[model samples]
Target: MVAASGADARKTIHPLFIRVTHWVNAFAIFVMVLSGWRIYNASPPFGFEFPAGFTLGGWLAGALAWHFAAMWLLALNGFAYLAYGLVSGHFRRSFLPISLRGALHDVLVACRGQLDHAPGRYNAAQRLLYIGVILAVIIAILSGLAIWKPVQLQALTALMGGYETARRVHFFAMAAIVAFLIVHIGLAVSVKGMLAPMFTGRAEAPR
Candidate 1:
């Protein structure tokens, strides 16, 4: 019994540290999105505004306050997670060896509803999706900073094709991230017991 328990303990799929940082990042993103919507509504780039009920804060100033606070949390926490993921080899184990062919196969299988997951491992589709979203987040941050400080970060604004372009980029990046989030949430709920490991850390050992 003792030996079995020891083996089971090694099967943890989402370590406690990962869980903590993941939740913190999620919260930060949640706040940033809602507050960002409010900020965007003040001078919508697309000529339409998010429903006030779906936004954070009562007005532009309040939204800016919340957005800036959450932006710091997201940036700091994201850096820590990225450092840990790289140094601990977690990224290697979980999201690696990506290739066009492999992703295509996964997509095809997924479309057929025949895709499956290996315990404690990511499928190609999951890896690609995660990678894409990470990039999107990075883009959002850069474009947002440019929009938030066009005069101060003149170089960044220029890199992003000036202030007007940066705003559009930020909007599109946020939209992509939101779309990925919807799909991610749907999969988590639809897949049997898939969401438990993130909270509990351990999962059934692979046969």
Candidate 2:
């Protein structure tokens, strides 16, 4: 943990893999949000539509491209992290914690805005969030594909309650992921500045 001369005060900010894939995920999320909005505009929801001057072609076509492209970025960054975590042994030490009861307790605290006492490298609440996001991403991809090619995926679409129903589910899943991201960032700032550890790979407490 030796710091470079003159840069002694500033710690190492992120291992190479972490830093790279993190930014990549951030960028891809941004693109997904932007393109997703455009796609939404074509079909409008809740009686709101994309402005008249703005059009991202027909709804399905635009959404399909943007969604799949963003999916690749998310998947790439995710798998990279997976490999790194396993190889570096961080997955077990820093990521895995046996505390289902404690986790549930932490969730209650988080709901009350009392994150100061949350435990573990990621806290129970944070762990739940990360896990939820991963699941949501998978769900969104599957639901999206069902919607995109209902005819080809007729079985899946049927399982989802039909083509239009699958599309609705996909849209809802995207919204849920976005909501989770917002809350995640907010929670990070709430507790010990979470970004620093992601950047520096070190926190006040050992992983």
Candidate 3:
């Protein structure tokens, strides 16, 4: 454990590997999102294009390179993160045993701005959201593979309801991830000292 000062004491809440993978995954996702937007602009998936200025990669070819590079990074880093989480018992320790009743209660408490913030334990709402985001990421990756190699991965594309449907699913998964990122950043910034763990591998514990 680590320590801070006053009522906002801190402890070594995050391990070194967790910290590394968290930042790596974050960067990978960031690059993937921006470059993906540029790539999408080429085909206009929904008949509308993302603003070029707000996207990364100058053009189609550039975007494809960036997107593919980031995709591999995301996959490798995510796999490592998941493996470590499981092997280290982090997933069970932090997110398991979530009951529906407990989750609902926690959600209501969160709505009232009263969720607990104990060290080393995730609240029900956080556990649920985190799990949901993980599932979304898996969906995004699968759908992306279907879109990227429809011929080679015909089974996957067919499973996802064909090429166009897989494209739409990938888009929606990306949208969900973006939405989760917005909410995650908002919540982290809104709380004092909440961002320290990912950066310093520690967090302020309550007195």
Candidate 4:
């Protein structure tokens, strides 16, 4: 076997802990969706009423357990991501392109299929979408927690326009995440040879 040389020790732009945390967050979202749906089915929400007959799971008790447990997992994953970004200096690279005017311009360009030529770690459109999704996740967690522990977080619920409004906002946040996932995965697949970086830490393209 050949001995390792200095060149073998060089670092590259591959998936780091932040990327791993992001994927874990994605998986946690999936689990949350399933458990949340089960909970919703047990008490179907139509405008306002939470009917018991809609439940498809074992019972409301089980559904609550699953939902809260999945929620904690999601929250923990998000916290870990935040800590990684802060500790590793990855946040600067990820969040640099956040100008509203520039993002809007990029959005228009993307709509016209002109983003292929854009350069940067994240093009304007990607920056807008990623930032928006992060905000959405934050809102989702806060609203959900308020609803989950209404008596404990009554002030927060009221801040979000009362309990009923908080619930609606929480649902909207979940929808945003689902929609983002569809678009994000589609982009990942459409890009040629993009999967290796996350596992190995070196992106195929120059950073």
Worst 10 residues of 1 by lDDT: 1-10
* Local accuracy of candidate 2 as per-residue lDDT tens digits, 1-207: 443333444444356687778788878777666666677776765577655334333466776587677778877787887789789976666556747787799888878877574333467656667767767877777786787788988998898889878877877888888899888777668666466667665443422
Collision pairs in model 2: 14-199
Off by over 4 Å in 3: 1-10, 205-207
Cα displacement (angstroms), candidate 4, residue 67, comes to 1.6
Which has the higher lDDT value, candidate number 2 or candidate number 3?
Answer: 3
lDDT of each: 0.89, 0.70, 0.88, 0.73
Rank ordering of all candidates by lDDT, starting from the highest: 1, 3, 4, 2
Candidate 4 ranges with C-alpha deviation above 4 Å: 1-11, 46-61, 117-120, 205-207
List candidate 1 stretches off by more than 4 Å: 1-10, 205-207
lDDT of 4 at 75: 94
Evaluated at residue 41, the lDDT of candidate 1 is: 96
| 10 residues in a row with least lDDT, candidate 2 | 1-10
Models ranked on TM-score: 1, 3, 4, 2
Best by TM-score: 1
lDDT value, residue 93 of candidate 4: 84
Candidate 3 per-residue C-alpha lDDT over 26-77 given as tens digits, one digit per residue, 9 for 90 to 100: 9999999999999889888687889899898999999899999899999999
TM-score for candidate 3, please give it: 0.91
Off by over 4 Å in 2: 1-15, 49-68, 83-92, 95-100, 110-120, 204-207
Whole-model lDDT, candidate 1?
Answer: 0.89
Cα lDDT tens digits for candidate 1, 38-60: 99999887868999999998999
